[model samples]
Structures are given as C-alpha cells and as structure tokens.
Target: MNKEDVSFEIFPPDFVLEPYHVFRKNALANRNRTESQEVDHDMDILYQFWSHFLVRNFNAQMYNEFRSLALDDDFSTRNASTGLHRLIQFYGASLSRNSVMPDQVVRDLVDLIRDEATTRAEHVAFYLLRSAWRSGSLDPRNREKIDSVLDAHMTAELEK
Candidate 1:
C-alpha cells in the first residue's frame, strides 16, 4: 500500500500490542489524568457526578427517560441511539434480579411519596415501585406500607 493508504488504514490497537502493556499504559494515563483533573476541576467533576447520581437515584427520572425511548414515541429512535435505553434496560434487569435497593434510593422513593406525590413525586414513585417490584423485594409481607402508598399515588396519577 502507498504511505497514504497505509496511514489511513485502521487497525485495532489491542490487536497489534501486548494487551497488558496497552492496558497498563491506558490505566496509568487515565489515573494520572483523573487525578490532575480532579485537583483542578473538583467542583465541575463533582457536579457532573452528582447530576448523574441524581438522575439515577430518582427512579422517576430514570423511567421517564427510558420509557420515552423504549416506547414508539417521536424521539424513541434518537434516544435509543444515545445507548441510554440499553443501559436502563440492563440496569433495570439487574435491579430486578439482585434485590439491591440502595439506602439513598429508598429515601428518595419515600420523599416522592410524601412530598411530590401529586406532582413530580408521582412519576418517581411509579418508577421506584416498579424497580422494587422487579427485584422481588417489594413483597406484601415486607413492603406493604410502601406498596400501598405507591399504589395510591399511582392511582392518583392515573386519575389525572
């Protein structure tokens, strides 16, 4: 091949190098970069992480964002193109099977039920209950009160 052709040819980096060496270099670079960036941009990085955490912690946000894409809505394809739909589906399935409910997540769920039920809380509660139900941890014997609250909240939402 001509030099230009050779230069333009795409080769998978991992295929050409010892995987460990490539991985070690990448890991070292990533660690150094993150450390330096964290020191210089602490608030910016923290805010970014916190925003991601909130979007994930608030089940209503999670469900609305995902369901909007999973359904045949106008932006479904565009949303799916962002890969969030798959991510949400995987996360939802994992939550359903693992019986893992973080303390913060539960607290947010409760807050939604008590404070935002008529407005934003309603949607969040719906998503939270669905996640809990999927995890098989939302059984009547264990979470009856919360379940009842969610049911009532959902009923209210539907009526609107």
Candidate 2:
C-alpha cells in the first residue's frame, strides 16, 4: 500500500502523550486482547484505547509492517494467528477504512492461515478475520477487497 492509498486519519496530538506513546498504548492493547471476561466498562475502555492508539493513527506503513511480520517465512502458527487477530481487531475498530487492505494482503493472510493454522485458537482468529474482513471490516458503507490463496505457500518456508 502506498501513502496515497492510506485511508485512516492522522490522530491529533492531544490524544497521545509523548512520554508514554508506544509503550503505554502497546501495553493497553496487549492487555485487552481477549474474548472472555468483559464488562461494559472494560469494553468501553477497550474501544476507546483501540481507537485512540490504532484506528486514528493507522496507515499503509503500519499495515506493511504487520504484513511483513505475519508473512515472515518462519513466523510460528501462534504468532500468525495472534497477529491476524490483531489485524482483524484493527479492522473492526476502523469502520471507515474497509478497502484499505490490498487483495494480495488478504491472500497472504489466508494462505498463512491455511498453511500455519493448526490450533483451534488459530482457526478462530482466521475465522474472525475472514468473517469481519469479508463482511465489511465493520463498515457496511464501503466494499471490502479481500481474498485468499489456497494450496502451498507461494514462497518457500524460509529458515528461521
């Protein structure tokens, strides 16, 4: 994805504190990433933190980094699955940027899922990503452009 293709908006400075930017936000995101044990208050905080940290500052470069990390040849199934969940959660929170991801990204995600997904957790993450991205990325307004590549991975699984 190119800079011109970035659809998410740049966040305002008031939303982030310089002293605790990456460390603080990452801690929050990693903390809330789960399915069970949610109260309304916690969900609200989760939504707020997600929007504040990820959706507002989302861009092609971030997507590229995620793509590179997840598609890394030796990325473990656990990593791929967890990574895909993170991507989907980002997608769910950004209801306005449905088509931001490229087709190849979708294919890469799917290819990785099919190839590396061995655990139920991994499959669950893939299922959610597929469902959310395919349905709309939480945005019913714009059409999403996601696809999958079946069979063996195009590139050989590189040595770690």
lDDT of each: 0.41, 0.44
lDDT of 2 by residue, 1-160 (tens): 7745864467663554334456445644653464433323332343444433555665555566554433341134323234444555654454345435445445555555555465444464355554554454444432233322443332222110
Best-fitting candidate, scored by TM-score = 2
Q: Work out how many backbone clashes candidate 1 has.
A: 0
**CA-only RMSD, every prediction:** 13.6, 12.0
- Residue 63 error, candidate 2, Å: 2.3
Please state the error at residue 135 of candidate 2 in Å.
Answer: 5.7
Output the worst ten-in-a-row residue range by lDDT, candidate 1: 74-83
Q: Candidate 1: where are CA atoms >4 Å away?
A: 1-95, 121-160
Q: Which portions of model 2 miss their true places by more than 4 Å? A: 1-16, 19-58, 67-84, 91-100, 116-121, 133-144, 147-160
| C-alpha TM-score for every candidate | 0.27, 0.38
- Clash numbers, per candidate: 0, 0
Model 1, span 43-72: residue lDDT tens: 233223333543445455544433343232
Best-performing candidate as measured by lDDT:
2
Q: After aligning candidate 1 to the native by TM-score, how far in Å is the CA of 83 from where it should be?
A: 16
What is the lDDT, from 0 to 100, of the residue 6 in candidate 1?
60
